[model samples]
Target: MPVEIKLFMCRTDNFGALLHDRDSGETAIIDAPEEAPIIDAITHSGWTPSMLLITHHHGDHVEANLALKRRYKLRIIGPEAERDKIPGIDDTVEEGSVIPFGEERIEVISTPGHTAGHVCYHLPKAKAAFTADTLFAMGCGRLFERPAPVMFESLKKLAALPADTAIYCGHEYTLSNARFALTVDPDNAALQARAAKVEALRAEGKPTLPTTIGEELATNPFLRWADPAIRKHLGMEKASDVEVFAEIRRRKDNF
Candidate 1:
C-alpha cells in the first residue's frame, strides 16, 4: 500500500499534517493545532483518525487532542515525559518505540528542550520527519521552556538525520527566519539565494516548508554555528559549540 501524506496549514501558520494509507484507510493526525481544521480535513477525506500523534504539549500542537479523541475515540500518542501536560494521551511512547499507522511505522525521536517533552516523529520508510518547533526551515525554535544548550543538543540529533529526509516543521516561520539567518551569515551565498526565494514565495502567499535536512544544513545559521565561517561572521573566536549556538540564538531573539 502506498503512503498518502497530505499536509495542511492551519491556525495562523501552524501545520496539521494527515498521513494515511489509501489501501487500509488508516489515518493519523500529526500535531493538530485546532479541532475544527482536523475535523474538517478528516470529514473532507472521509477517513476517521485512528491516531493523534502529539509532538509536544504546547497548546498550538496538542490543544485538539481531547476533542478529537472524544469525537473519534482516537488513540492519542505522545511523549511519556509530558503526560502531566498533554491531554488525552492514550500511549506514552519513548524514543525507540515504533507506532503503527497502517503499513507505515513511525519511529519516535525524543527531542527535548523545545519543551521538556518535545519529540519528533520519523517514518523511515517514507523518509519523512515531523519536527515540531525544534528545528525550522532556516532556524531553530526559541529556548522557551529549557536552556539554550539543551535545545542545541536536541537540534544536533535532528541535524544528524539523512540529508534527504523531508522535514515538516510545526510553523511557517521561514520568511522571518530567513531574514534573521541573513544577519548571522550575511555573506553566505546560499542564504542570499534562499532569502530571495523565500521572499518571492511569501509575496505570492505560498507555504515554505517541508525543507530537507541538506537544505537546512547548508543555509540555516543555527545548524551552522559550528562552522568556522559562521562563527567568524558572528564575531566569535574559539567558542564552544554550545556557546556559539547560544550567541546565535541570542542574536536571533534580538534580531
Candidate 2:
C-alpha cells in the first residue's frame, strides 16, 4: 500500500509532517519542531508514532525530540554526522543508507549547506522527499554552515530526482521565496504565475507546499542558475553555473 502523509503547522513557520504505513501500523514524524502540536496532531489524526526522524540538530527541528521519545518510546533516526547533537537518536544514517519503514525504504540524501549535517529523506515508492531546510517551494535554505557552491551541488542532487516527486520541506517560507525569486527571474512566466498563486494561497491562509520537482525546475530561481535569463539578469551571462548560483545565494541573503 502507498504511504499516507499528513502536514501540519508547528512552532513559528515550521511544518510537521507524518508518514504512515497502514499495513504495518507504523507512523513516523518527519521532524519534531514542538511537543504540544506534534502530539496533538498525532492524537487528532489517530495515529501512534513509532519513530521520529530528525533531519538536523537545529533547535526548531529537534526541540521536541526528547519529549516525543519519552511519550512514545519512539526510535529516533538522524544524520550520522550530527548524531551527537540530535537528542535521543537511536540510529544514525548518512547518504546511501536505506531505512525500512513498513514496505517502503527511506533513502537518505546528505544535503549539507544550511547545516553541515543536514539530510533529506526520499521514499521512492511514495514519490516524496522530506527536504528539511535544503530545498523550499521557490527557494533554497540560506547558506549557513557551508558555501554556496556546496549548497548548489546539494540542490543539484535533488533536482536530479524524478520530476514528479513531491517535496515536503520544513518551513512556510514560500511567499517570501516567491517574492525574492521575481527579482532575479522577472521574465519567467511560470514563476510569475506561481508567485500569483502563492500570494492568493497566503491571502487565504493556505499552504503552498508539497511542490514538485517539475514545478521547481520550471519556476524556482535557485534551480535555474543555468538559465540564460537569470544569468543575464544578474549580469553574469558568461559565469559558470556554480558562480551564478553563488551570486543568487549572496543576493538572497539580503533579500
Candidate 3:
C-alpha cells in the first residue's frame, strides 16, 4: 500500500517524477517537464500515469503537459491562482486543498514566491513532498514574482513539516547550493558533511536528492532564519526573522 516515487531527468537539471501507488497500481506524474524522458521513464517502469499534478505554470515544468495529457488522457490538477497559465488543468487546487491519489491524500501547500502561484504537494501517509521549484535541496527557487518577505513565509510552511518528512525537488542543485551554504555557515559540521556527500554523489553521476526535512533543518541556511548563530554570522542578530531571511536570500542571489 506504499507509494513509490521515482525521479527522472527532464530538460537539463529539471526532475520529473512518477508517484505510483502499490495498492492500486495507479500512477501520478508530478510535473511534466519533458515528453520523451517521461515516456522513457514510463516505458521502463511500466506505469502509465492517470493524473498529472502541477505546481506552477513555468514552461520547463509544464511544457509536456499537453503532450502527456493527450497521450495518457490524464486528469491534470494545478494551482487555482495560475489556472490560466497551466494548460489542460482539469481541477484547480490551492492551499488547504486535499485531493486523493488512489488511496493516498495529497495536500496542497501554497508557496507563492518562486512564482505567485507556486505550490507543493505533500502526501501525509507517505510523509513525502514534491516541491518542484519552491523548496530545493539546500537552496530555493529565484524570486521571480513575489518579494523576499513572501518567499520567506512560504519557506516557513515547508520548515514546519515534520522533521522526518522526505523532500523531493525539481533540480539537482545541492552541490552548488551546499557550496553556497558553507560560505554562510562555515562552522556547521552537518552542512560540511552534506556538502561532501553531494560532491561524491555528483562525481559518480548519481542523484543527490530525497533530502529529509530533518537533514535540511540541520543544514539548509534558508530554513535556519530563526537560528541565533546564523543571525550573528550574517550580522543581523538584531533583525527580525523576515529581515534575516531576506538577507540570506539576497546573499544567495548574489552567491
Candidate 4:
C-alpha cells in the first residue's frame, strides 16, 4: 500500500505532517512543532505515532519532542550535528544516511542554511521530500546560521531531485513567498498563474502546499536564480548564479 500523508497546522504557521506506511502500519511524524495538534492529527487519522523525525534544532521544530516521546515512546531521530540540542533524539543521522520506515527508506540530505545542522528527509519511493525550512513553496529559508552561498548550494541539492517530487515544507508562508516572487520575476507567466491559484486557495482557507518540484522549478524565484528573466530584472544578467541568489535573498529579507 502507498504511504498516507496528513498535514496539520500548529503554533502559528508551522506545519506538522504525518506519514503512514499503510502496508506496515508504521507512522512517522515529520516535525514536532507542538504536542496537542500533532496528537490530534494522529488521533483523527487513526495512526499511531512510531517515530519522530527532526529536521533541525530550531525550537519551533523540536519543542514538542520530549512531550511526544514521553507520550508515545517514539524514537526521536535528528541530525548528528545537532544531537546535543535536540531534546529526545535516540538516533542521529547525517547526509547519506538511510533510515528505514517500514518497507520504505528515508534518505537524509544535509541542507544547511537556516540552521547549520539542518537536514531534509526524502522518500524516493514516494517521490516526497520533507524539507523543514530548507526549501519553501516559492521561497527558501532565511539564512540565519549560514551564508547565502551555503544555502544556495543546499537548495541546488534539493533541486536535483526528480521534478515530480512533492515538496513538503515546514511553514505556510507560500502567500507571502508568492508575492515576493512576483516582484523579482514579474515576467514569468508560470509564476503569475501560480500566484493567482495560490490566492484562490488561500481565499478558500486552503493550504497552498505540497508543491511539486516541477511547480517550484517553474515559479519559485529562489530556484530560478539562473533564469535570464530574474537575472535581468535585477540587472545581474552577467552575475554568477550565487550572486544573483544572494541579491534575491537580500531583497526578500527587506520585502
TM-scores of the models, in the order given:
0.96, 0.99, 0.98, 0.99
**C-alpha lDDT of residue 39 in model 3:** 96
The stretch of ten residues in a row with the least summed lDDT in candidate 2 is: 1-10
- Which residue ranges in model 1 land beyond 4 Å of their true spot? none
lDDT string, candidate 1, 1-255, tens digits: 267777777899898899888777888899869889888888888877788998999889988888889999889989999988889888898888899776788999988877888999998878889998999999888888899889988899899999999999999999999999988888989999999999999999988978999999999988997888888887787989999999999988898
| Local distance difference test values of all predictions, in order | 0.88, 0.94, 0.92, 0.95
Give the clashing residue pairs of candidate 3, or none: none
Clashing pairs in 2: none
- How much does candidate 1 score in TM-score? 0.96
Model 4 lDDT-worst window of ten: 1-10
lDDT of 4 by residue, 207-231 (tens): 9889999999999999998899888
Q: List the residue pairs that clash in candidate 4.
A: none
**Worst 10-residue lDDT window, candidate 1:** 1-10
Estimate, for each residue in 133-192, the C-alpha lDDT of model 2 and write its tens digit: 999999999888999888999999999999999999999999999999999999999999
Over 4 Å off in model 3, which ranges?
none
